[model samples]
Target: MISIENEGKVKHNKSVATKLTPIEYKEITKLVEAGIYLNSSDFVREAIRDKLKAIKVVKIRDVDYEIAKKEVLGYYRSHLEAYISEVAEDLELDLELVIKITNELKKERRLDEV
Candidate 1:
């Protein structure tokens, strides 16, 4: 059984034990000696909290990226013909390239009625 001291009270927790290298142990000891943490356990607990928070942020960012990607793709898929026509008119585009794309869209039945 593992115990964590919370507000002067020790609470038993189902914790897994792991061994750290001598160097890692020394670093935690150094942190405590420097008064950075009350003890190695508190440092480990805070480190775990920080790591979990970082993972949560990354997951949220990935979800946001996926949502943004879907919205952009959907917009392009629904407005491809109009966007192509507008681009060809509004920009100095290569005639050959434009013709090739227009032909491809025609084959795909995506070109608007001229």
Candidate 2:
């Protein structure tokens, strides 16, 4: 178990065990010694967060793409300027896909180039 302190409150998190290859263990240890991470748990937590972000973009369908495009357009209409990265993060979409949609809008003259 690990105790995390947030906003003057302490929260306890359960510990999970997993097996790693010798090389992987060595690498993690070396990184910790180099101060890349606080410890193995910190590294694992960061890895898990990165994996979750990657997993968020899977098997997007055409309908989903259309919906995202409409959302992007609506957001642009409301905002004075369209920031592609902000739009992607706000909509929880892949940045590349958002850029593609923005480019399409520019090509169609639906959105002005900024």
Candidate 3:
């Protein structure tokens, strides 16, 4: 399991920012009234943080994909049965599902005919 180091920390900087239009303000009011958040800033910050973390996770995974794929490909070449078992073991995947994915990879020409 890959663990990500969350270096994100909250900074306390109080600065008055821009104003929203009436309709935008009303939508923010609705969100506050919905009892889901304390205020608009809370809502916006949470939304931004969630979106940022999602993008970060994807970026981190993307950085590792090529190397991981290369290792998977190597195992895929040498001993297919062992490779499938290894994938299932490492990912805690179901045997049937792993086999299905392996078959699909072969079908897609991602894996050589063995």
Candidate 4:
């Protein structure tokens, strides 16, 4: 059994066996000695979680970008600032990024009002 401390809570779970190359094993051990990770299993689990979160964020950002692009095109000429602010707030994204994307869309002539 292996235990990991997560958010001040101790979680106990059965350990799964995994084989690591010599270099990888050494890296994990060094990280442990450096106090960067409690153990190899915990480090691997955290790394996997971080990677999955990054993948999810990329997918979500893509969807948000498309939606923002459509919204920008809709209210671009008439209410540019309002629409930009609204999209930024709704998507919980950086305002500058929203503005930059909108500018790019405008420059490409992809956001002409119908």
User: Which numbered prediction scores highest in lDDT against the true structure?
Assistant: 2
Off by over 4 Å in 1: 1-12, 57-114
* TM-score of model 3 vs. true structure: 0.40
**TM-score (all chains, Cα) for each model:** 0.41, 0.46, 0.40, 0.42
Superposed by TM-score, candidate 1 places the C-alpha of residue 18 at a distance from the truth, in angstroms, of 1.0
What tens-digit string does per-residue lDDT give for candidate 2 at 51-76? 99888544433348899899889888
Residue 1's lDDT within candidate 2 is 62
Model 3 whole-model lDDT (C-alpha atoms)? 0.65
Q: Is candidate 1 or candidate 2 better by TM-score?
A: 2
Ranking by TM-score: 2, 4, 1, 3
Ranking by lDDT: 2, 4, 3, 1
Q: Clashing pairs in model 1?
A: none
Q: Report every candidate's CA lDDT.
A: 0.60, 0.85, 0.65, 0.72
lDDT of 4 by residue, 1-114 (tens): 657696887777765678899999999999999999999888999988899888733222444667766655666555545666676666656677788877888789876533
Residue range 1-114, candidate 3, lDDT tens digits: 234445764455554577789998898889899998899988878877899888731111222444555555566666665657666555444555556767767787988764
